[model samples]
Target: MLWGALPYMVIVFCITATIWRYVTNPFSWTSKSSEMLEKRLLRWGSLLFHIGIFAVICGHIAGLLVPIEFYHWIGLSDEAYHMGAVFGGLPAGIIAFAGLVILLVRRYTARRVRATSSVGDWLALAMLIIVIVTGILATSANAVNHSGFDYRTTINPWLRGLLVFQPDPALMQTVPMNFKVHILLTFVLYCVFPFTRLVHMLSMPLGYLRRSYVLYRRRDGAIYPNQNQEQQKERAM
Candidate 1:
């Protein structure tokens, strides 16, 4: 049931919830930046978290979507591929988890940020921490044990089958316990994604291309003589 039914259910829930949220309250779809309250931690944490997570995502895509045969055809041996995965993925996961921890700490320890945070914000951070920790455990275990448990033969195929609607539960039956936990938690994260600020990840700044240029002025400075007229013109345009 975990391998077969849960994935599809989460996918449907994510898609439906995302659409519903968009239609119901489009203006609420923002990351709600707190840079004004605290800049030091936020700058470092946001930078590391985004960079590491992007790398981790790219690794998952290459590992799961691409076939083993293709790698072998390209003259890459199985041992070499696994080595690269461990060396590359382990660091990326560690970096992302570290960044998330920093961000979580900043959120609670900073007074202004904490006051503004909602339950949904805490839920998102908690879910992310769980998922990243499990992923790190899974990768670290494989790196130390070198158990020859080649996931390309099992988990990769299972996930690809899921994409095509022909998932085989047997493929996941023998997967390592840590890997199973990570996979399940990942889907759980997806289920919570649309309802959290994480939804902002799906947004793009395309509107900036056509939107009017923003006007800025010093808070205590005198207003420009034509500021009102310029504002009126932009609104009319």
Candidate 2:
């Protein structure tokens, strides 16, 4: 039931909740960065986490979305792909996990941040950690240890088919336990995504490019005599 129904259910919920949140409380849909409360750990953690996540996302897109035949046609063997996945994915996962730990610690240890953090924040962190850990386990078990369970054959088709409304639950029957767990957790993450700070991931800052320039001035209203004279001359002109 989970393999067949959960993905679609989560997709609908994610879309509905995201739209509801935007319509109801659009201004609250932000990351709510706590940089002012603590910067040192936040700086390192944010940088490493974002970099690792970008790499991990790219790796997933290549491994899952692109068919294995494309790699073969390009003169890339399965062994080469497996080795690259392990070598590249392991480090990226480790880095992201480490940064998440730092961020978690900072969130709890920093007095001001802890006070300001909502329950949703902690829930998001917990779900992210679970998903990342399971993903690492799945990647390590299959790619690093040579488990002979080529996910590209089974999982790839299942996932792609699911996207096109052609889910074949039988394909997941032969899949390993760790991979199944990772996939399930990912779907669960999507279910909770719209309610958490993860929603910020959907945002793009294109507005900043066209924003008006901000001008600053002294708080005091008093103007210098020479400046006043210059302003008056310009006004007269």
lDDT per model, in order?
A: 0.90, 0.88
Residue 172 displacement (Å), model 1: 0.7
Give the distance in Å from residue 76's predicted Cα in candidate 1 to where it truly belongs: 0.8
- lDDT value, candidate 1, whole model: 0.90
lDDT of 1 by residue, 1-237 (tens): 789998999999999999999999999899999999999999988988998899999999999889889999999999889889999998998889888999999999999999999988999999998998898899889889978887888999999999999989999888999999999899989999999999999989899999997655646442544456666677577
Candidate 2 residue pairs in clash (backbone atoms < 3 Å): none
- The TM-scores, one per candidate, come to 0.90, 0.91
lDDT agreement of model 2 with the native: 0.88
- In model 1, the runs with Cα more than 4 Å from the true position are 217-237
After superposition of all CA atoms, the RMSD between model 1 and the true structure is: 4.8
Best by TM-score: 2
